[model samples]
Target chain A: MGKHIRTVNANQAILRSTLQGRGCGECQASCQSACKTSCTVGNQVCLKEKKQ
Target chain B: MIHKFIFDDTRMVFDVHSGALHIVDELIWDLLEAYGALPEEELAQSLSGKYLEEDISEALEEIKELTDKNILFSPDPLGGAYKPPGESVVKALCLHLAHDCNLSCRYCFAGQGKFGGAPGLMTAEVGRKALEFLVNSSGERHHLEVDFFGGEPLLNFDVLRMLVDYGRSLGREKGKEIKFTVTTNAILLDGRIGDFLNKNDISVILSIDGRQGVHDAMRPFRDRKGSYDVVVKNIKSFLESRDYRDYYVRGTYTALNTDFSCDVEHLASLGFDNISLEPVVAGEKDHYSLRDSMFSQISSEYEKLTRSILKMTKEGRHINFFHFNIDFEGGPCLPKRMSGCGAGHQYLAVDPPGTLYPCHQFVGREEFVLGDVFTGVRRGDLTRLFRNSHLYRKEGCGQCWAKFHCSGGCHANAVIHNGSIEKPYSPGCLLAKKRLECAMYLAQWKNAPDKS
Candidate 1:
C-alpha cells in the first residue's frame, strides 16, 4: 500500500512539473488571469496551490 | 505538447498551454473575436450605436498591441510602425514593370501605351536595387512579396529575370521567402516563355476580357490588328503543360463585357483559377456623362457572374474570386484601417528615370515621388508620405462600422476621383457596399432551410 501511494505521488509530481514548465514557461503571468474563465482545471490548481 | 483550443472556427486552432491560452498575438485574436463572423453590413450596423465607441476604442488598442507583436501583419512589404490617416495596414504593392506596350488598348490608363510622356522599362540594376531595398526595409524577420506589373512586363524580360534572381538571393540570405507575381496581356506569352515561367513558380495574371470580339474591341496591337487568337493560343499552350497546369492564371475583365453567362464559362474553360472583373474607370469625358442605367446593367451582369462563380467554388470547382473572398480567420478586407494599403509605407515603385512613386498608378505625378532610389531610400520623405496623419478621416471614417474592414478605400483613387481622400470615393465605396451586401445575403441564404 505504501509503495502504491509512493508511485501515485511520483506520477503527480511529474504531472505538476510538466504543468509548471508549460504554464510558467513565459515566466510572465500577464495572461494567467485572462485565461481563468477558459481553464477551470488550471484555475483550480492555482487556487489550491495558493491555499497551500 | 501544445494543447490546441479552437474558438469559433475549427480550422483555426488556438494553442493552449496549461490553463492559459497561448495567444499568437493580441491583434489577430481581437480581430477574430471582435468581428465574430459578423458580415460587413451587420458589423457596420452594430457599430452605428453610440455605446459601441468604448468597445471599438478597446479593440483598437488590442490591434495596436498585435501590430507590436508582429503576428498580425500589414499588406505593406515595407515594415514600419507608420499608420496613415484612416488607413489599415499596407497590403499590396502596385508595381509597374513597363510603361510601354506593344498593344494600344483604347482605355489604357498609361495613355494607349504611348512612350512620350510616361517612363520606360525598369532596368536590371534598378530591379536588383529595389529587391535589396525591400529586403533591408522589411526588417530581419518578415517575408517579402513582389508583384511585377506594367503596360506589359514581358516587354522587359531581362529586368524581370534579374529581379526574380535578386529576390531569391536576398530571401536565401535573410532566411525569408519571396513571392513573385506578374500581370500581363498574354499576347507575348509563347511556349518557351510559358515553360520557363512554369518551372520558376511565377504566378501569371492574363488580360483577356471575355471573347475575341470583346477583347479585340478593347485591346488591339499597334498595327490595329486583333491579337486575341495569339493570346488564346498561348494560354492554351501554358495550360496544356503539366508544370503550368497548377499555376495561378487570373483573368482580368472590364465592365464593358456585360454578357455574364457566356464570359464566365468561356474564361473558366480557359483554365483560369481566378477572375478579377473591374469596372471601367470613366475617363474625364465619361465621368461627367456617367449614366446610372449603364451602371445598373453592368452591376446586374456582375452579380449573375459572381453568383455562378460562387456556386462553382462551393461545388469544389476550384475557381476563386480572391479580390472578394477572404481566407479563414484572415485580416479585414480592403476597408480595415488596422493594416492599411501598401502605398507609400510598404512599397514604393521606381519609374525608368529613377523617380520613386508611392505606387505605379501614381508614377507620373511628380508630387508623389518619395525620392530617387539611386541615392538610397529617403527615410524622411518616406516617413512624411507614410505618416500623412492629415490624410486619415478621424471625423467621418473613425466612427464608421466598416472602418476596421475597408480602411476608408484607396487614397490615390480618392484623390483622383474626389478632390481629396478626406471624403470617400463614391464608385469604389458603392461597389464595395453592394458586394458586401451580396456576400451577407448569400451567407444567410446558404444557411437557410431548403425551399424544395
Candidate 2:
C-alpha cells in the first residue's frame, strides 16, 4: 500500500493535559466577551511546543 | 465528519470525531472525499482513469487501517442521546465591580458599561455576599475563580481590593483556593495598583486595541480624545513590573480595521508576549459589525498573521497569540469540548447591584437575570437550559467538524442574534472555521517530523 499520508496525532505533541475536562473553567474566569475565549480553553493548559 | 482545507500549499485534514489531524498527499486527500460512498474496488474502478489502479488500491488500504484504529472517520463517541451530568456547581463568577466606564468605547457591548441601568459601583457588602454565594454554591469544587470585570473595574478600586482580601480569607477558612483575574482598560493602572495585582498573584487582561489609530478609533475617552498614548504608556510599565508574565494585551478588531493581523503584529512589536485580538460583536446595523462582505479580507488577515507567528517562533522571539493557542494533547475533555464555557451553570456573572446573569455579555438583558447573589441561582430553568446547550443539541454543530474545538460557540451571541442559544451566529461561525483551519495548519507544521 502507498503510505502517502503523513499524520500527527494530538498525543505526539508536548502539551500539559492537566486542564482537560475542566471545560471552560479558567477561560470563563478571565474572559470578558463571548468570542474572546474561542481558543482560550486550550490556553488554560498553555501549548508548550515551540519549534526552533 | 472529516474537515479538509488547503492553506499555503499544505493540505490538512481534521478527524472531527477523534479530534485527530492528518496531513495528506493530494491522492489520499482526494480519495478521502469519495471514501465510504462505495466499496473499495468500485471506488478505484470509478477513478481508474485519474489514478493508477495499484496506487488507488494501496491508498484505500491505508485509509482502512486508520479507520480501524479509530483515528480517522471514527464514529461519534457520544452516540445520539448523550445526557450531561445532572449536577452542576458554580466554579467561576465574573464580578462587575463598576457598571460605569471612564472611556466610552464606541463598540461598548454593555451600553457604555452602565448596562442600560443607572451607573453604579459595587459596594463592599454586595461583593462579600457574591463571594459567599460562590463558596456555598460551589459544592465540592475547591478551585474557584473570580474575575473583577466592569465598564472599568478600577473605578471601584476600593471595593475590588476589599473583595480580593475578603475572598482570600474566605477561601482559607473554607479550605478552597481562589484564583483572581481582572480585565481593565489600563487607564487607571498606576504603580500602586500594579504592585497589588502582582503581589496577589492576580492575572491581568489589559485592553489595548493594536496601533494608535485603530485603537483610538474604536476606544476613545469621554471628550473624544485618543486614549492610545496613555494606555500604551501604562501597559508598558505594568508589563515590565510583572516580569512580562501572567497578563494578556487583549483587543477587539472591527470592520474599520479589516487588516486586523497588522494590529496583532503591532502588539507583538511593542514587546507584549501574550496577546488576544477578537472580532467586534455588534448589531448588523452598527458601523463596526463585521459585515458579510468583510469575511474574506478578515480571513486573509488571519492567514497572514499565522505566517507572522511562525516566523517569530523560528527566531528566538516568541509570543502567545490567544486565538491561535490550541492545545492538541491536553485539550478540554469530551464533555467540556461538547459543552463550552458553562455560562448560567458552572460560570455566571454578578452585576454591581448583586444581581446575576448567565455571563458578562448577558448582564444587561432582563430575561437572563438568574437571581441575586443573596438568593443564589433562583432560576433553575435557565441554568438547565444552558446545561443542555451541548454540541449535539446545537442546530448545526452535530454535523460540523469544528464542534469540539469551539464547543458549540458562544451561547450569549447566539441568543442575542438568533434569539435562541441552540442556534449559532453565522458570522462568528465563519470566523471560527477560518481560524481553526489556520490553527490546524500551524499545528501540522509545528509537529512535522522534519522539524524535529
Candidate 3:
C-alpha cells in the first residue's frame, strides 16, 4: 500500500506445504515466489514481504 | 498489550507500550481484555455471570485504577511518536578509528573489520573534526562519551593519543567531561599500548570469546591460527596498567559453543570479574548461526550459568554476568522509543572520510548514511525514513508485547535477515524476551526472603 508494491496469495508464497497441517491458511503471504526461506516450527521464516 | 509470564503463585504482566508492570490474579487478567470493550452497565452485567455483583464492582474499580494511569487503555496503542530527549546534544559519538583488524572474527559485523570496503585507518584530521563536532553539538551537556571503535581501535594508536590530548584541552575550555573508551581484541596491546592508554586516561574494553577452544574456533588469526593464548596473555598485561579496575571483558557465543555456560565459568576461572557474554549474530543459513534446534541447549546453559553465578556470589566472589544485572524496573516510562538504541537522535556513528550513520552496526551501509561531519545531518527523505522506522510504524511490532523494550528491534539486522527495516526479526524478539525473563528471575532471586 505504500508505493510500488505487490501482494501474493497463499498458493503463491508457500512452497512444499508441510505434512503437519501448518498450511499458510489465515497467514498473510506478501511474496509470490518459490520459498527460498523454509517454513520452520519457529517463526524465523520470512513469509512476509522482504524488508529494507 | 500485556505479555504475562507465569511464575509460581502470580504472573508478571509487562505492558509493552509503557513498560509498566502489574502482577494480578487470573480473574483480573481475564477482565483486562474483556472489560475495556463494553459500557460499565453492560460490562457489569456480562461479568455478573462469572462472579458476585460485589466482586464485579471491585473488578471494575481495579480496571479504572489502572486505566487512569494510561496503562490498560492507552490512547496511543503504538506508543506515540519517538521523543528525542528534548535537546539535540551530541552526547555520545562512536568513532571508527580503524576499519581493519588482525583477527578474522566469523561474526564480525563490520565485514571482517574492513567494513566490506577498502582497509584504512581514520586520519588525524578526521579525528580532530569528530572532536570538534562532539564539543560544538553537545549543547548544555556536561558529560559527553566518545568511543574509539573499529576492526581494532588500537591499530592507529598515534591518532588516538593526539585526539585524546586535543579533546581534553577542549573539554576544559567548554567545561565538559569527555570520557573516552576503546573496544579492542587485545592482540596488539603491549606494554607501550597499555602505558599510553593509562597515561591518556583512555579506558579499554577487551573482547575475548569464552574458553580456549570455542574462542579459537570462532575467532582466528587472518592466517587461520588460534589466537587464544596471545589474547589471554595480553589481557593480563593490559590489566596491569593504572586504574584498570573499570573495564568490561566482553565475549560472543555462537553455534560452535552451545555449552557456553562453560565459557562464562571459564572466564570466571581466568580471574576476570566484570564479564558479559553476547549471542553471536550471523546469517540464518550460516551453519555456525544459533538456530531453532540450539534454543534448548542455549536455554539450559543459561540456567546453569545463572545458578553458578549465585553460587559464586555466595562464596564472596565478585564475578558478574551482564545479562542478569539489567533493571527492568528502571527502563524509560512508556511513550519515547522507536528503535532499540537511541540511534538517529541521541547517538550517531562516524566512519572514515566523515560519513555519518545512525549507529556502528550500519557503518558500511551507504543507504543508511545520514550525512557527513562537514555538511551536518541532511534532514530530508533519509532522515524521515530513519525517524519513521520505529516500533509504532513497524508492521509486526505494533501488536508485540516486547515492543517498547526492543523498540521495533535492530534496524540493520531486520534488513539484513528479513529484507526490510520495517520488519521485526522474530528470533531477535525471542532472544530479548528470554533474556528479560532471566534478568527478572535473577532480580527476584536477589530480593527473595531467607528461607533458611
Query: lDDT by residue for model 3 over B1-452, one digit each (tens)?
Result: 55667544444555544444555556666566566577778867766778778876776776666556555444454234444333344556788899999899888878878888998999999988888887887777666777888889889889888989999999999887887888889998999888878877776678888899999987899999989999999998788665447577888888888888789889889888877777777877877888987887777777677768777877778675765654443322232234334455446778877788776777887778888787677754654565556566787776766565555666666777788778767776776667666655555555444411
Write down the lDDT of every candidate, Cα atoms only. Answer: 0.50, 0.81, 0.65
- In model 3 chain B, which range of ten residues has the least summed lDDT? B331-340
lDDT of 1 by residue, B1-452 (tens): 12222222221211111111122233333345545367634654565563355555555455445334332322232121324334222223345668789888876656654333654887887777666666666553254556777778889877887777777877898776776767778887886777667777876666776667777877789888997888788777776774444344443345555564466567777766665545554455643223455567655665676677667767768664433442112221211233244456655666665666666656677666677656754555554544463214422544333333344555566667775645666656655544543433343334324411
Q: Give the distance in Å from residue B386's predicted Cα in candidate 3 to where it truly belongs.
A: 2.2
Rank all candidate structures by their DockQ, best first, as comma-separated numbers: 2, 1, 3
Expressed as tens digits, the lDDT of each residue in B277-384 for candidate 2 is 898878889988888898988999999999998888888677788777776655555656666778879889999989999888889889998999888888999999
TM-score of chain B of each: 0.71, 0.98, 0.83
Clashing pairs in 3: A51-B419, A51-B420, A52-B419, A52-B420, A52-B421
How much is A50 displaced in model 1, in angstroms? 39
- Per-candidate interface DockQ score: 0.02, 0.27, 0.01
lDDT of 1 at B333: 22
Which candidate gets the maximum TM-score versus the true structure?
2
- Model 3 scores a TM of 0.75
RMSD of 2: 3.4
Stretches > 4 Å off in candidate 1: A1-52, B1-95, B114-119, B242-255, B258-262, B286-293, B310-318, B332-337, B379-395, B399-401, B444-452
Looking at model 2, give its docking quality level: acceptable
